[model samples]
Target: MKQTGIPLAAPSNPNHSRSLSVGQSIRHSFARYRGVVVALSLGTLLSGCGVINNMMYKTTGDVMQGFSREHTIPYLMESGDLAMGCAMSEATAPLLMSFGRVTDEPDQLAVMLYLSAGGCAEDQGREHELAALAAMYERKGNAAEDAMIRQKRAYALASKRYLKSWQHHNTYYGESGTGECPDFDDDLDEFIYLAGLLSGLQALNAEIQSTSSIGVPKNVGSIVARASSCLENDKWWGAPMALKATVWAMIPGAQPEGEDAFDRLAMTDRLGEEAGVRLSHVFHAIAATNKGDEAMVKSVVRRHAESLKEQPANAEWAFVDAMATNIIVSISDRLWVENTGHRTPLGQLGSFWDDQQKEVETMDLDGLL
Candidate 1:
């Protein structure tokens, strides 16, 4: 049964309660949860009007739908705690999937569930990539002769997880070169779909970086170009621009006529900062790493570090923001392990060996003892 007397969109006045008001709301709650309402009413009354209003709002379907936009999706995007977010998403997968059972393919709930599942897979892929980095470090050390083998295994796993992420995207939105637009509920859903496309490309990039045996796909450049064309630069906090700039920087001659890769990358950096996402910096840093341009890498890293210091709080699109930081940190961590036989310095995550003042440093000796 659909609940009425609730506004589908936000009420024009913040203080305006719906037509149901408190008495009707109480009756509706009583009807839905009779005994349960009686037990909860005492505590709710003690908590004041705010709590009671919240309880009433939640009883309505419209409010519940709004809850997904304001709370559920934002939490998915902006959460700082990666482990907890992954666990929660995994736990809710069944419920999210259940929504799809009753809803059509183009339904909002279906899109949300698929986007969230894609995120879960992306997180798992990052974990596998981290494992690969650890194994790469082991290969650099003297004691681990099997590290190369382990690194290869981890990279393979990461690639698979990324593929899983994209598969979620393909389930509803279809794949690239399909010659169609996904029938999304709105702009937000379309943004999420495009983000999934980027996630898949990121997985391919990771695999290519990890091993020379697996070559980059010839069609990858066209895929990036097509993905970049779907959305305006402003959508989803300039994510599309970031994707476009990253491709230009990474793929030689990919930049459009009269436009340089450096200029496009610079524009992405500005857009990311304006949007408070800073994901473009992450992409730029990775591209620099791929090119072995140590100077460019250091420049990107320093700017990223400064940006983080300025806006440490990720109040919006938290997941994307954190993922960007995670990638940049991994890049620095690898550089540190390769040079100093240790991870990046405590709290100095993005700084690398090039920042060191001297080539030689003091070492502990048995003679000193």
Candidate 2:
């Protein structure tokens, strides 16, 4: 057997060699472009992730904000537990405020939360004040001074928080008294407006108590008094009038002509008592305390205690009534602590340590026995 070798034939078209070269060039170009395509795709994917994350955050913040305003606030308002409300506000404020980084800030909620948190700080300050009083009673001068320092520090913190509340309020509602009252969206909006006014006034009061330059505006008192007129005194359970009267009592010449501050306070007290809200009592007591009118303070407390017995708190606004009562109790405690070195005894809110005893018919009781 013999083996035969065959030679390959040449390409039919002359351009076949050119076509091969072109194909090779195309393949090389695609290979180089593949890296660039991969880079572009990765960049697009990362950009999409950023968009998705932002949308998620915004949605979450919106839902949380709505739920808090609609459900949480109303439920809290119905509750009578001031301590629990204060604690919740203090704990959740930071978490809620952080959402502002991703979305619009919840300024209305900030007003309420910061105000409540400021109250918590004020309560701490009161505790220190009580301790200072106790130390003074014991003649411990150094201990009293130290407690006073701590009290002022707590008050300073309270003032700062309250001022923040006032600032946020201005952000949300625009500068108050710049023009006509804001067109309130609903009852909640009106309520928040009132709260904002209270926040400004409280910021001023707290700064004064702190004895520190916390930068609270001195004109806040007058502003709050004027702003308070926006709310109807009767609709808000006499709170608006009480706020105005309190300003008049505190700020010299703030009262308008023919308006007696004490008379307005007395009228508001009756209105509050009738409404079962009784927030006016707090204002009256505060003004009395500021004036060093111990008798007036005691009268306010006694009247409040009597009103509680005469009329229960309105069911829809029990929390507000309860808070007013809590403040009254604190005032009573301060008086008791100052004189008796203790808080008011349980079941004796209206009575004092030196209250006059009523005469009893001892002979009739013995004969009956």
Candidate 3:
């Protein structure tokens, strides 16, 4: 009779009941803290995103820095396209410098970029100077004044940028004239060091030309002159000696006793010519111009032009040679514009307006007849 009725089920085991209760407790805890779990998941996702972003930025910066140092700079150095080099420096500097926000500041690259961009500005200033001369020759007083103003403005910009380049150079290689030279890793490093020295000198010169307070140190000329000793004059195509000589020529009392600035410049000229990198000629011309020695300036230009005919540019440093030629041409153009109201005539970089024409020996058709 008991079996016919519904039999009572055996009681569940206490351990089983306890396990069920624990499972419920876990679910309840999870439900209560669901918002916290979601927040944690979101935080993890965001943190991962930040890591990925940082990695991407780092990769981009590394690639840009490497490409610039390895390929871009070397290629530009080998090429003889001054305009293209200037354009590239002007265009890419901001973009490259922007990487500093996320990565190490590219101080080494900044030295080159600012140096080049300063050159671009200086070139524009030269052009304005030429325009001013042209306007003066034509008796256009207002135009001449405007052009001179523009020229000074450009020079001021150039001074600022050149100063920035020098600053970056110091940042990367320690300050020059610190009583110890940096241990250069390679030729490129040495070259950059030399460039930094040049940038410093140029900064001071440009500031003087600008007639504006660009805060270039007054002692930069002496500092660069001292630092130039770190480099081998002959190894760098006489550039070190040329730099030192220019400073001596420019700064009063800078010339040490028994050291003739002009004589040293003359020696450097020969050295530069033999190397097919006549940067010394530019320095010579600048010194002569500052001294108001028109004859010497013309002689330097003539020598440079003749040297170009006798020796082609060194293939390894064609761009540097080309740059020297460009500056020399600008100097010639200034002379031409002042006297003849125009730039140097095409194919006449070394020729001047006042030169005596050589007698041309013509074939005697009449004698043949």
- In order of appearance, the predictions have TM-scores of 0.64, 0.89, 0.88
Q: How well does model 1 score by local distance difference test?
A: 0.64
* Least accurate 10 contiguous residues by lDDT in model 3: 1-10
Number of backbone-clashing residue pairs for each candidate, in the order shown = 3, 0, 0
Arrange candidates, best TM-score first: 2, 3, 1
Q: Which stretches of candidate 2 lie over 4 Å from their true place?
A: 1-35, 356-369
The best candidate by lDDT is 3
Candidate 3: lDDT of 332?
92
Cα lDDT for residue 59, candidate 3: 86
lDDT of candidate 2 over 1-369, digit per residue (tens): 565575367799989999999999999999999999999999999999999999999999988889988888888888889999999999999999988999889998999999989989999998999899888878889999999999999999999999999999999998886646888988878888988888899999999999999999889988888888888899998999899999999988888999998899999999999999999999999999998999999999999999999999988778889989988998998899899877889989988988968888666677777
lDDT of each: 0.64, 0.91, 0.92
lDDT (Cα, 0-100) at 73 in candidate 1 = 73
What stretches of model 1 exceed 4 Å from their correct place? 1-71, 90-145, 177-184, 209-221, 312-314, 358-369
**Candidate 3, residue 27: lDDT:** 96
Error of 2 at 25 (Å): 7.1
